[model samples]
Target: MNPTAPHDTPADLSVAAMTERFRAGDLTPVEVLDAVRARVEACEPTLNALWWSDLDRQGRAQAAARASAERWQAGEALGPLDGVPVTVKENIAVEGVPMPGGHAAGDPPTATADAPITARLREGGAVLVGATVMPDWGMLSSGVSSRHGITRSPLDPSLTTGGSSSGAGAAAAAGYGPVHIGSDIGGSIRLPGTWLGLATLKPSFGRVPLDAPYLGRCAGPLARRTEDVLAAMQVIGRSDPRDFSALPAYTGDYTRPLSDGGADVRGLRIGVHTDAGCGEGTDPHVASVVRATADALSDAGAEVVEIAPFMDEGLLADVDRFWRVRSWADFSALDLEDQRRILPHVARWCMAGADVPAVELMRCYHSIQRMRATTVAATVDYDFVLSPVAPMAAFPAEQPMPYTDPSLPMQHIGFTVPYNMSEQPASSVHAGFTPDGRTVAVQVAGRRFDDAGVLALSERIEEIAAVPAPVRIVGA
Candidate 1:
């Protein structure tokens, strides 16, 4: 195993800090990748964060890292994230890996081309370390998929790390790398980031491409710092020929202003969303952490005000229904034999939605339109909005939801789903830890295409929150 930097915290190993070290001749890209690989190896056996390591490609990654190191030595790095080690979530295509999408058994065909976001990572000089696990077609909120089993939280092996970006969150929090590419349709990115105490961005739809066949899903970045997400956004948000969904504006460097000026929350009108219209229950600890984040923003010179749920109850229910039916049909259409390979709860969840009529699906669309209007009206007077990313902290790793009640499908997702409907930029940053030590996260939302603004606010929140300790493998 590669030796540790003396008392290095996860924050100290952030992409920004590592680049500075590289520039100062303190480390090489190969050395950083080696250490990250060591960390991944140590954590993988227990946490199950990875689906495939792509060992055959390590030589190429090392070669790229060496090239990046040479550039850094000559004071000419390739890009903002040159040489940073990054992990891609499994459902997003990586050119040479088997993407099982968390099924129990199948030798899936390797992707012949990289996903647009993956191509962007390469453009930024990021070394793709491996692909991480996700739920079957990213259908569930917990990490217990049929193929990879359960992905435990880095903080506590018995608890969940969140899904369908489950393994990405685990890898990020476990010090596997500084940046992890994840996808979110409902709360996949934010849920895992919240439960695992990492910084993640779910950019405005079209800010990042929806290269895969699914609707409403977008690629995002998860990292130890919001700045890293911003850096990644600058790369992956570029328009690609492969995704007709990508917007054409191509404004340069999402991270430039935030990186140059630092986060300034002053004079911004912020709305706090504690209850997201759905009657979903919130854990008291989660609520307190969110309120504390609002208080911090208020103290940081931003105008903070409490706000009610953005979408109406019926609309919220439709959103849930949409996901249920939509997600089900995507997988249930597979051969009956293949369908049987999915995890029980995930299979059941998808099956429940498979029978919804075409008319019902149209209602879902109508509800989404109404939701977009509601969210726009609510945020029109404000520059940003704040809310809890999830209603609760990490639950048992084996369970599909935070609660056993029948409302489980709608429970944890209430705070996050609206943004997906609104196609707004949203992020989740560490809020605090529960007394039991599970991490809580707060969501920051901004106007459409205002990913930078959302990230800036999240950066401020990250600054005030305590950095989670790096997970140590005891008795390894």
Candidate 2:
């Protein structure tokens, strides 16, 4: 591994900090990537966070970093994330990387072209180290997959790093990489961040372009700090001609000045949903963490109100149907044998999609489309809506994933998924730790295009909570 940079701080240096170091000639991209590579080599045997690592290709990345450093030395301009090393979740295509979608047994075709977001990262001068692991077809909440094995949390190797962005969160928390690019359709990014004590952004739909098949899923980032997330969003947020679903606006700057005072939430109306429309049997720890987070925001000068109407219970079925249709579309392309060989939960979820009638699927789509206006209208008076990312913190990794738990109601995903169905911007910041030592995350939902606002709120909350770096997995 490359020797640590002279001025490199062991911790608290986010991706933005590292980028500044690169620009000031204090660090090199090669050094950053090498450090990450060494960490992965040392940790993967226990954490199993990576799907694949192309060290030879990374050598080429090092050469490219040298060229970028030379250009900067010659006074040429560099992008915001120039020379930063980031990891992409396996589901998103990275040109030349196999698109396993988390099922190693299934011989899915390799991606010939980069996903739009991946291309944007490269254009911004961020080096792609490798693809992080995910659940098979990203169908479950825990990281146990037949393909990649289980991914443990950095804090405790016995606990899970939530999925389907499991590896992304694990890698970030473990300090294997500064930023991890992940996709969230149903609490994937936020849930992991919550469990691992990290900051993650689930941008408004279309902010990051996702080509065919996975279009409904929003691409996002997981990182140690909110600043790194903001820096990454600036790059991957670019509009792509390939995704017809992508919005028409150019990428806007996500970094902004925090509110005047650490306590300045003045005039900002915030809504808190402790019940989260999850019906009965919500975890007390989850409720307590969320309420505490709301109190912190209220103490920060924001008017926090308990609201229920903002959450629509009718939206769950439609969201389920939407995912079903998308999963079916992707699964149909695979050979029958390949389909059979996929993870059990993935196969079960995709099989359910085959049963949904075309008319019913259309109804589900139309229902979601029509409700977006209503959902947006309900939040017009509030600057942001706060809630829990998941019903509970990360659970133990289960072998045969549970698709639908009879004990937990359909609204188990209540706090999330609706925003995805509405295509609005949402984010999760580390609130604090639970009594049992698990991390807790608070969800922030903002206006359709106001992703920056959501990120701003996260930064403020991070200050109030003072989240600590996740504990590295022991004996890895």
lDDT of 1 by residue, 1-476 (tens): 11154634332377777888889998888888777767766778889989877434347777778889999999998777898888899888888887887777556778888888888888888888889998777877788888888888877788888988999988887777788999998889999888887789998888787566355677799886788887778778777767777778677557544432567677778899777767466788989988988888788777898887765568767877787887677676678787778777767766778778999899988888888888888887888888888877788998877766433456667778778878888898877878887788889988988888788778777776545533433112
Q: For candidate 2, which ten residues in a row score worst on lDDT?
A: 1-10
- How big is the positional error of residue 20 in model 1, measured in Å on the Cα after superposition? 2.0
| Local distance difference test values of all predictions, in order | 0.78, 0.75
Least well predicted 10-residue stretch by lDDT in candidate 1: 1-10
Q: Which stretches of candidate 2 lie over 4 Å from their true place?
A: 1-12, 213-215, 258-263, 309-314, 325-336, 370-374, 399-411
> What is the alpha-carbon lDDT of model 2 when measured against the actual structure?
0.75
> What is the clash count for each candidate, in the order shown?
0, 0
The superposed Cα distance between candidate 1 and the true structure at residue 387, in angstroms, equals 0.7
**Alpha-carbon shift of residue 234 in model 2 (angstroms):** 1.4
- TM-score (all chains, Cα) for each model: 0.92, 0.90
Instruction: After superposing candidate 1 on the true structure, give the runs of residues whose Cα lies further than 4 Å from its correct spot.
Output: 1-12, 55-58, 256-262, 405-408, 465-476
